[model samples]
Target: MVFDIGIVSNKKILLVDDEEDIVNLLETVLRKEGFKNIIKAKNGIESIELCKREKPDLIVLDIMLPDIDGFLVCQEIRKFSTSPILFLSAKDEETDKILGLGIGGDDYVTKPFSPKEVAYRIKAYFRRHQIGSGKQTSYSIGNLSINEETGEVYKNRNHVILTAKEFQLLLMFCKNPNRILSKNLLYEAIWKEDYLSNENTVMVHIRHLREKIEDTPSKPKFIRTVRGLGYKLVTQENI
Candidate 1:
């Protein structure tokens, strides 16, 4: 898990948490990992303001804030930036995790989490972005078109806004058109972690992705369920 210090030092990270100890711990770990440009916010308002002003590359957000919860903050931020957001919340409930991911979070880590693990997650995200870059490619299926180079998605020529994770999911599907993708395969591929009965996590992300790319999520025309198997993206050839 060695990262390029020069690259890591240049990437700005925003940490939003009212808890001083939590913020300090994350900052310490990130700094030790060679991330030099780090910003901190104590409330949702400050976080939003910092996000606009600083334009961070990634954000570590907390659910419980002084004013406006992290969910609302994420919604507001989504209006402007597609920067990856990782939720760091004390609530470990499945519902909270689903809501966080559905709203736009790229990852979620419950409180009492290891500082080192959080650092590693941040590095993993940056690494994925680096690997995904340098590819000047575009794919089109039906009315859906994706530009991998620009990370832009369009449906019937209308621009579509997608969360980071959602974009990755659709890109994966596009690369494997007409092929059924199992939940375990997707979870491991996108999350970069072993699957541990995290079907709901993959399901929620796919549902959100479908809402953006499908004409009707309830009766999806593109990304369809394979009943007992998995999900597949239907291309023009398949259609």
Candidate 2:
């Protein structure tokens, strides 16, 4: 299967893995898919340094590195950059996937995986970002107003900063006010993939999301838990 995702063709990609063969293979595959500016790193420390130096558009990171592991690398990168991160790991456990996503990874691929799938995922990230760029759509409930195209949230007339994922999640809720959105639905819509059995993946992101937009994160007003079902967003006018 070939993807001609031109929006990501010229984008820079950073590949981090201890294995030389995996790095070589991914580089070749990504290049074949039209990605030109590709860089490689062998350890977590080097990867971090490269991220700071290169500021690549996308990152393909291995979970286990020779020095600091990919999770820490992700954590450190999130501090300075919001570039989309894809985790490549040999461990296929649910806990690992949850941990990776919880820390702000955009996607996770278990090892013995297809390189073409990884390339497609990278293209998907760029496509999503393009969709989010430079448009105007408004969602206002009480004092909270979100501008989807601009990726801005104003709470109580004050600006709020959110991660890329959080903004998308909130936009999903805003578009479907008062509708019950199940975890599976939310996962597929936002992540653009099938829902794995990791409930905490969505849960943690929602928790972090509430912390930013809710008056009281502990007792939320806008995004409400639906007890045994899922989650819904409520507006004062709707009530």
Candidate 3:
């Protein structure tokens, strides 16, 4: 059977962050957006384990956590899942937002943000699945396999846990390997405009990803930088 271009309802979403007020507020917001099944986690560690079990369709993550930072959580979750991740945090710095995106966040929103806007952005993403037919499929390069349907990645056939955003970044690279993805292009693709700038997000996520998939992050083999250009994934040559 062919899958749709986007994912639609009845699926659950895992909401993770260290703040109670934010969690509760988002839970309510998600419900208002027609996300009936929602799960919550207070910190990065809890988010990781929760993802291993519940397997929500998407994730709402925070950058600052009690145990691990959200970026690492994004890395950890990317290990085994591809659920869409949207960041909600007070760390509105350009670097912080880019870190979330470059690591693979689908979207980023700073705290004191508009809940209505966030909800609207999410619905737009989900709409992709609701529209297209034949479904965007999955593929692999060497030991790394991507299941476009589930948005999950595997290394040596072992599920690599990743936050929703990390999965998105990886997916973008996988789809357009060997193409130099400029920082601006990446920022636009991941986080909708009106919320991005030159910073450490892409660099951080690329570093984090290198740590995971690269045999040697210092000498990356999969995702490579073009120095003056951007980043590209190598099908054969090392980065």
Candidate 4:
């Protein structure tokens, strides 16, 4: 059976790491996965400049770059683009992961991760972002409007800019309204893998998503936490 993998089928990827071996390995893996345009950068400065010049679809960045570090790199890139960023780091601490995600990163992978796993995560990101393509469906909750066909969200008639992951989370909530979606379920569905103790990862993304879509993120109405259970999107029918 043939399938159409939109958006990502011909994405240009930017791979940034100081280690040549890691870059080579990821390059090989992405190539085998059928990615055509892959660009490489060795240090933080080069990565930043290359990102501006190339404007790749996604970026795989290492945190321990020789110059400025991946966190700083992500901050810089966010100034110009909202391209999806996946951090590659040896820092596996929960704080590190939270900090990375807090700083506009779409995802993070600790060091010693399977190259295949990284490839899969990237593919999942692309898949979720492409879910709305070729569809004219729109969903509304309160004052917010989501146009799936154009991949756009609006609050009070103003456009809301969201990272790719945030948009995906919102879409998921729209599709499964009134159901308590556990963190593990969300992680697996969106990231295409089993949850690996990344609960805080989901929290960070959810918080960000709420901030964009809610009148008051601190007292969110659209996305409500079920405490011990998980989260659910409460539309007008449930309200």
Indicate which candidate wins on TM-score: 1
Model 3's lDDT to the true fold?
0.75
| lDDT scores in order | 0.90, 0.85, 0.75, 0.85
Among all windows of 10 consecutive residues in model 2, the one with the lowest summed lDDT is 1-10
After aligning candidate 4 to the native by TM-score, how far in Å is the CA of 3 from where it should be? 4.2
TM per candidate comes to 0.93, 0.84, 0.70, 0.82
Candidate 3: worst-modelled 10 consecutive residues by lDDT? 1-10
Model 3 per-residue lDDT tens digits across residues 104-180: 67678888887677767777767644534548688788778888776567889877766554566788898897899
lDDT of 1 by residue, 32-121 (tens): 999999999999999999999999999999999999999999999998888999998888899999899988999999888999999999
The alpha-carbon RMSD values of the candidates against the true structure, listed in the order shown, are: 1.9, 3.1, 4.6, 3.0
* Residue 54, model 2, lDDT: 93
Clashing pairs in 1: none
Give the residue spans of candidate 3 off by over 4 A: 1-8, 15-25, 40-53, 61-82, 91-108, 128-131, 134-136, 194-196, 237-239
TM-score pick, better of 2 and 3: 2
Candidate 1 residue spans exceeding 4 A from truth:
1-3, 237-239
Give the per-residue lDDT digits (tens) of candidate 2, residues 1-239. Answer: 34346656778999999999998999899889888889999999998999999999889999999889899999898877767789999999988988888787878899999999998888777776775335588989878989977678899998876666777889999999889999889988988878878578889889888887898999999889998788999886343
* Models sorted by TM-score, best on top: 1, 2, 4, 3
lDDT (C-alpha) at residue 226 in model 1: 97
TM-score of 1: 0.93
> For each predicted model, how many residue pairs clash, with residues at least 3 apart or on different chains?
0, 0, 22, 0
